[model samples]
Target: MVSVLTKIFGLTNIEIAEDIVHDVLLKALESWKLKGVPENPSAWLMAAAKNKTLDFLRHKKQEEKYARQITPLLQSEYTIGHTLNNYFSENEIKDDQLRMMFVCCHDSINEESQIALILKTLCGFSVSEIAKAFLTNDSTINKRLYRAKEKLRELEIKFEIPVPSEIEKRIDQVLKALYLLFNEGYSSTEGESFIREELAAEALRLCLILSQHTAGNIPKTLALLALMYFHGARFNARIDDEGNILLLKEQNRKLWDNEMIQEGIILLNMASTGDLVSTYHIEAAIAYEHCIAKSYNDTNWKNLLNYYQVLITLTKSPVAELNSAIVISEIDGPDAALNVIFKIELADELKNYYLLPATKGDLYFRKSDMIKAKYFYDIAETLTSSPFEKKLLRKKSNMCT
Candidate 1:
């Protein structure tokens, strides 16, 4: 709704569009409480939006302030109704959404603002929810959003997708934001719940939209979507009824969504058509290996290790190296894994990361070094804010007693 309204009002008047949408929603709430929701709630809302838009244009048409590109059409009595009807059509709504995605991810705004804008405008996340997702205060999020809106207004960014030649560059920025949003849900950094399923679902939803668009139906986009599906398939098995964190090996394989897994495989194959091999491609392939494994013990560790090696070489991420070290422990021994962990050149960069010490604790436990295991586990427990992670670390520490 915001996207379509933005298209009508122009990017410079985004706040006007947002305010109108909010008013429409508020009216819905008040009316629904008295009269009950209409049978076709979606159509009802669309109709309400259309009526509100007509009212606004009729009142403001003389000012000639909205949608500069189509201001003349909007001012004319005959063209105004038809023009709006076209913009509010189903196909136009979808196109507006895609255009809005690109507009939110424009290079003028910083990355943080881009993500916040995407969540707010595209995903319907409230400011407080976005703050919670990022472990920040509402004031900070508000400021980020304020700055982003100002930038968009100052630049007069158009609500349209880039041309084919420029689409690839802009698409990467959009994908990166979506990837972070998904990760925040898959492994929440600071929250009571270990998983923020809504966030992940929203990210997947937006990515699916991107996949359907001509400008965004590229290999990298498909690969990211595949990765999301593979991860989403495991959501049901990732935690127990009590909400304690469950390691991959401890999860019930039966609970995994085979349908989602198959969908991921199909998308991954589609993503493999192009010559480009993005980090998303490697990550999705790694995830595919896990999905196909009948059991933890049956997992093809050798394949994962190779993928991680390529991932490390391609990205040079210490986190990837740490993960590769864990795979080494599976194939070689705990000692070998420990050696790799200790020798990591960027190990200091992970000093505050709970997983670094937690992985070490696991390696020590496997070596039957109880004192060292307990020490690392205690450190890991202190580093993470998530209650689920802290509980899991404490459980590991108890085993060393």
Candidate 2:
């Protein structure tokens, strides 16, 4: 709704579009309280927004001259209804949201600002929510948003999908932004809850939208969706009734969503069409290994290690290396895995990364070095801000006592 309205008002008047949306929502709250939600609530809201926008344009006259472009079409009530009906049509709304996402990823804006803009505009995230997402203050987020909106005005970027030639690069940015959003939800930091399922679901929803488009339904898109589905299948099993974290080995496989797992397998198969192998493809393969395993002990550590090796070759991500070391611990011994961990050159980056110390704690615990395990777990507890993670680390630390 915001996307369609913003397109009509021009990018320069985004706040006006936002204000209209806010007012429409307020009206809905007030009216619904007395009269109850209408049968077709969506259509009702669209009509209300359309009426408010028309009234604003008419009242402002020369002030909002940008609406002058559609003034003739909106001259009569009949014509105005016809024009707005087309704009708010189901197909047009989807296209508008997709285009808006591309505009947020314009090269003129920095990636951080692009993400902030996307969270704000597309995901309907508040500045405070965005600040918490980035582990920064609201003022910092506001500044990023200010700079991003100014960049949009300066560049005059259109609210349209990129050309075919530019689709791959621009879509990569879109994927990255969505991936980060999903990760934040999957392993949320300290917030209202440990897992922000809505944020992750929103990311998955946007990815599905992209996969439906001609330029976006590529191999990489399928792979990313497959990866997401594989992870989402276990969402229910990730937490106990009390919302404590569950280790992979501890999760009940019966609680996993088999339907999502099957869908992920199908998508993973479809993602194999192109010669382009992405980190998503490798990650999906690793997740597939876990999904098919009867038990944690039955997991194909060799295959997982092979996938992680390929992933490291492609991306050289520290997280991948850390995971690869874990796989080594399962196949080889704790000593070998510990040696591999010690040899990892990017120790500086991993120093405060809770996973590293957590992995070390697990490895030491497996080796029956309880004192060392407790020490590493203590460090892991301090490094992590997540209440869920802290609880799990404390559980491990207590085992050493």
Give the per-residue lDDT of model 2 (tens digit) for 102-180: 8887878888898788778887777898887767899999999899989878888777888999999999988887787
The top-ranked prediction according to lDDT is: 1
Give the candidate number with the greatest TM-score: 1
Q: Model 2 misses residue 157 by how many Å?
A: 1.2
Model 1 C-alpha lDDT per residue in residues 34-55, reported as the tens digit of each score = 9999999888888888889888
Q: Candidate 2 clashing pairs? A: none
TM-score, one value per model: 0.96, 0.94
What's model 1's TM-score? 0.96
Q: Please count the clashing residue pairs in each candidate, in the order shown.
A: 0, 0
Residue 5, candidate 1: alpha-carbon lDDT: 88
